[model samples]
Target: MPKSVVSLWLLVSACTTSPSHSQSWDFELRVVARGLQVPWSVLWGPDGWLWCTERPGRISRIHPETGEKRILLSAIEGVYARGEAGLLGMALHPRFTDSPFVAVAYTVYSGFVELRIVRYRYDASRDTLLDPQILLANIRVGNIHAGCRFLNLPDGTLLLSVGEGGIPALAQDLSSLSGKVLRIHWDGKVPADNPIPGSFVWAWGLRNSQGLALGRGGLIYGSEHGATTDDEINLLQPGRNYGWPSVEGYCDTPPEEQFCRDSNVVEPLYAWTPTVAPCGLAYYDSALTHLPQFRHSLLLATLKGSTLYQLRLSQDGGRIEEVNAYPLGLGRLRDVLVTPDGRVFVSTSNRDGRGAPQPDDDKIVELVPKNQGIEDTEERSLLRLWCQERQLWVEARAPVTVRVITVCGHVLVEWRGLPQQRWSLQSLAAGWYGVIAWDGVRREFSPIVVP
Candidate 1:
């Protein structure tokens, strides 16, 4: 095997273990916030704060450690909270620390409850919103099919999902913004590389897709609501139509009768029957060694199923299998997010008139892996190497110069400078390797995966 592949395999072997015979997984749940009326989405802010949106047009922040909650924005009018329409999606600016801008998607009460995406500036000193800017406007909305999801791509582009506006035909219409995935710049300008010039419609023919997430290799995936059967998870490509209304799950119609027969429609990666009502999605990239099976998998949140579905992706990127699906026992999960420290955070939407509510059911819950005393006997697995700090997790005593050598005993990465200094690993691939740390005269070798 190539050196990189061998390194990845070694890292996977070190981090993973045989599945436990016990069905119950070891994890602790903590209620991070409560008294939230139909919390829609939960996101980690740039300042390490957890922020959430309430369905009735309110934005709140929660202290992750203390579970303290503070209401930041409220009392905004025109939030249609019947069924699926309300404060739905939120996304922070890519450069949130410097820009302090937040984008929100909400439903208006203008006869038909139009969905709109607006941007607001956060006033840190006053702890409130300073200026509100309407970025996207005139999105048709109804009691159902108000698809509102936001994603701030790594390339600093904004991607928003708009539903079919309660009319299936709207998804096929190129002129309408409804039933389409729109891509725009930060300032609401259409991207120059969009499928059509002067058009925010990057891809079309989507139903009520509520979940949008970017995966490895810059692939975009979305979860959509089905009419009766065939809820879908689609692989998003620029300028590709998803064949909504015209075709439901896959191409079930004849070639001549298809809606986008010659318009380059894309098929879904995975589809579910009987509907899971998937809401939020996040990609896990092997950062958490505790749940090694979930590494590089897509964690999907479901409302109707009331369970978290873990889809293990194939290395070839063409197939995805449902590896694990477990019930949260919480009421109506709306969103699932992986924190910076490898903890899983999920938001519940019990107040939305869906699930059986309990005392702390409608709050955010964090999942922490329980250390089951295996660390004492089992070998310490190197989870990942953060080269920015130049820190190593040494398991045993070894030469400090071993990290610079290849498997064939050739030098790859070398450094000779101040001890314990931080060094960024921008030139490294996602894999496993050995790290050697020295404390004066003593040295130790540790394995690490760079995911």
Candidate 2:
């Protein structure tokens, strides 16, 4: 329950032959939309829709329930649809309902490719994007290692993670805009409180950092790709160097230690040796209203590794307590997003040339828990056990002892005094189960079936 405890927890579960492996199948992988041309970025919009960006320079809004897709913005001119180029990340304005502004990062091809971050206003009536204004346009774009992920901070400024643009030296160069996390105001001006004067660079020395996450306890986390080994996750700080070319994962080597001490370089909290190619990063905090089990956790989508990683963070948010790696048989995942209601969605990058495509090469898939709906009881209307798809919800007005038991008389979980409780059946196998809620005066049984 403590924040620091979750950060230090680590669980390494490989997707290999194991009798318990079948429990992962309990999560129903449903394709929400198909025929997508390399869908790159996905987010749950403020308008109660799933907003998506295809690498071919188009924006779409998808209905979560009906799977009805609408091409909201298209006909994007001057877009470079090359390897690792085209439209990348997008973020809705914090005040989206009133301002209706959206920020997008894309590669503009002319004589050379350049990564540009721009803001666009949406016309709700026409369902179109209008009034495009370029915010940051000096970033050089590379065919690979073009890291541009967005993190809209609460203080009206946006934190942008910039890769070294395939050039290792650029990460160490303070003058270059590449290979740094830049903080800029919504109107494209550098914040006065920037670590460096007249510069937007908040942190530098990063190589292809694709994921920037701010978790509980004011800890800033980032994920970067390393050459062969040392794929890293860092505790990012302003004006800090992440040791990209000179140092990979940790500053453990003698020579690397010398540079680290001389340069005041910071080490990563965690790193992967074989290189998972971690991309989309999302931190689960109290902000998520639906998925309580996922709270105080960080989720990352990996490309080459083809896995969804869930890390339980500590109460201090300074450490990683545990990591649960869920392998996705689907080809190269590009993005991972969670909704306010606890629904998780991921987009495949299989159509991105490097990966072999499936029938729906670049589709958006939803991961649903097995037990979907909750069961109701007549004993007390306020006392309810509801399961929706794969999530079990228990609603009780007073203190009660809740026990989840298997059909074979094995108790799986037990909790006490929850006004409302939620449990994800992701790890549970398909079988019959019972949920018993015992108050001082009476006992109630709720049957659960997972198929």
Candidate 3:
């Protein structure tokens, strides 16, 4: 078979579903760790461990399998743990197997809290930190507006987010590192292809961007903190200026207006009102069958709303639509990440003294897919076929196909490929059924029943 035909077959066999069942999803909330004083960011580190940063300038490594926590680093220099100023962002090197380097963004006490970036080597054999290299420093600081997040771009360049200094005017100043995104080589050297040669600055005119993620087509997207309203998400381009203090969201001022008239300024792709206080962002790439509309959608973590906002993108990736928002109800979600195995992990910031706290708040939670590894034998009558396949869960308008068979090898209701597939057997009598789905090549079987 051709490659496309093979892919179609895999899709058919992999898109297994459970019986058409209707039940509220019960999320199994597991606390990864606690006693963390204002944990900011979490990243998967080398050697299958998850590394997390505490605002008071400490790094902790948590073993996902064993629930073992180890303190990695502490007391290098200048970590202001007051309010939002503390150890902020971290990213492991792409070639971590060989390099074993980790980058961190934090606030240092230089009379005033100043944002700084540093790189450290993790000695796996000795289980200790070896060399510490201060990559970038002297970022303007304030009680607020210290935009400190770092991400490694797909092209091996490191991207850093700098917030507008305490002064809003710094956002418009080209000379200041504040209120800009800086791109640099892995060794902390300025890239030659940077918009300004010999300068670490990549793009300017940002207010207080909190989250950064590189998505499809190498597009960099950032979520910004708005003053009162007009929280925005922008497509980050190197050397381009995004109107910050000048204009918020889409241009409300006219073309000839003073700040808005700058034709060189770029506009945001999407903006929200009442301020979601967007934090970390991640793109979902999973084999879940109910996620057709969310294939390339951006998962945004909101602190103010305590929800995960899913923004759906157009096919060509030029436009974005706010498809759905799921409330975590966990109080001040700070960072959201998807693991390599397609499990969604989110970090909460309720302990940061910002939001109302829950009993078991301020910990990481993993979201598991609905039907996998879960048994419903005890509540058989409560279970209905949510999908034609017995392994998948029900979602809105998803295609489902079912097959019925006997104990022996015999032909049964083999509803193979779904051209306009719709299986509504709610009125049918209750009995055991074997469901199978075919995508033109291979078949997947799931045992289900209607009671």
List model 3 lDDT by residue over 1-451, tens digit each.
1111000011122333323321123333334655466567888775777788877788878775455778888655657777678888888899998888888888877877688888999887776666889888888867687877888888888998888756788887878889999998779898999999898889888888988986777777888988887898888898888887778888866742556565478878888777779888877643433333345778788886456777777665567854465554455788887665555667888877776544544576655443445333223221123534434342212233445443122335544333344545444345434444433322233343444
Per-residue lDDT over 267-304 for candidate 2, one digit per residue giving the tens place of the 0 to 100 score: 98888887888888888775664545567788888887
* TM-score of every candidate relative to the true structure: 0.75, 0.77, 0.75
Task: Please tell me which model should have the higher TM-score, number 1 or number 2.
Answer: 2
- After best superposition, candidate 1 residue 292: deviation in angstroms? 2.6
Tell me how far candidate 1 lies from the true structure as C-alpha RMSD in angstroms.
16.4
Compared with the true structure, model 2 gives a TM-score of 0.77
Taking all chains together, the TM-score of candidate 1 against the true structure is 0.75
True-structure RMSD, every candidate = 16.4, 12.9, 13.6
lDDT, candidate 3, at 163: 88
Clashes of 1: 1
Cα displacement (Å) at residue 51, model 1: 0.9
lDDT of 1 by residue, 81-141 (tens): 7888889899989898888898999888776768888889998887787677888888886
Instruction: Report the error of model 3 at residue 370, Å.
Output: 1.8
Question: 323, model 3: CA deviation in Å?
Answer: 2.9
